[model samples]
Target: ENNKHVNDTENTLKRQKTNKKGGPKRDEVWEYFIVDDEKNDRHYPATYYHCEKKWQKGKLRTLKAHLSNECLQCPENISKFWRDKLSTELTNYTRKQKTIIQLPLKQYQITQHFSSDKPLPLAITERIDRSLLKAW
Candidate 1:
């Protein structure tokens, strides 16, 4: 029937939208994160996210949605690329991201009360300066 054909066409279009070939996929939204490196260098993750204050406050059961980094740049979307191109591009990103030396990811938990909209506190800056002076 014509209706059946139309339905099939619609489904195909939906699936094709996410396929990584010759077109943009709308399924996954990209997120970038600024992860801290071992030597105080900052490396960004493809998707960066953390627990939200509301989640901690018990008002919300889940953390906030993932947010992209301000400076984190996303690589070009290479939809439907062949295996060889995919491998080469991946290797390039890995190689380019390497610093003087590769550093292990350090995971630490801190009880900092911060909201996404709030800026860093003055006291924190002062403390950082004081700590640096002490090191000097």
Candidate 2:
């Protein structure tokens, strides 16, 4: 009974660690893809579209681009609808992200991706350049 209790406690801890949410809500684009239990790997669905084209998971941007703008396999009308729908949804999401009023640099952090472990340099004179300012 003591061994059983220890095993149960370890299992419970594993479940708690793995049960964290996978980030934001599922996007509408997922509706178009088929979910198959037998074919699905641990991370991504085996097939990408209802048409059963091969695609990897965690490539949401690529998936959206294919469905919204470039998939010839999907019916033209469906592609057209998604193009409009995705465009509107992305626009709204961008607007919402832009409204976060934390700090001047917070906006930059929100828009940019930086995964380096190295600390930032003490000074960044490039930020003051006219071309960089205009681009931003």
**Best-fitting candidate, measured by TM-score?**
2
Off by over 4 Å in 1: 21-136
TM-score of each: 0.16, 0.41
Candidate 1 weakest lDDT stretch, 10 residues:
55-64
| C-alpha lDDT of candidate 2 relative to the true structure | 0.61
Residue pairs of candidate 1 with colliding backbone atoms: 20-79, 20-80, 21-80
Clashing pairs in 2: none
Candidate 1: residue 109 Cα off by (Å): 50
What lDDT does model 1 reach?
0.37
lDDT of 2 at 69: 76
- Residue 128, model 2, lDDT: 53
Taking the candidates one at a time, how many backbone clashes does each contain?
Answer: 3, 0
- Model 1 residue 102 CA deviation (Å) reads 25
On residues 1-136, what C-alpha lDDT tens digit does candidate 1 reach at each position? 6875675566456545435556444223221121221232221122222221111121110111212222122222322222344457558874345557667977654545446467669998899999999999
Reference-based lDDT, each prediction: 0.37, 0.61
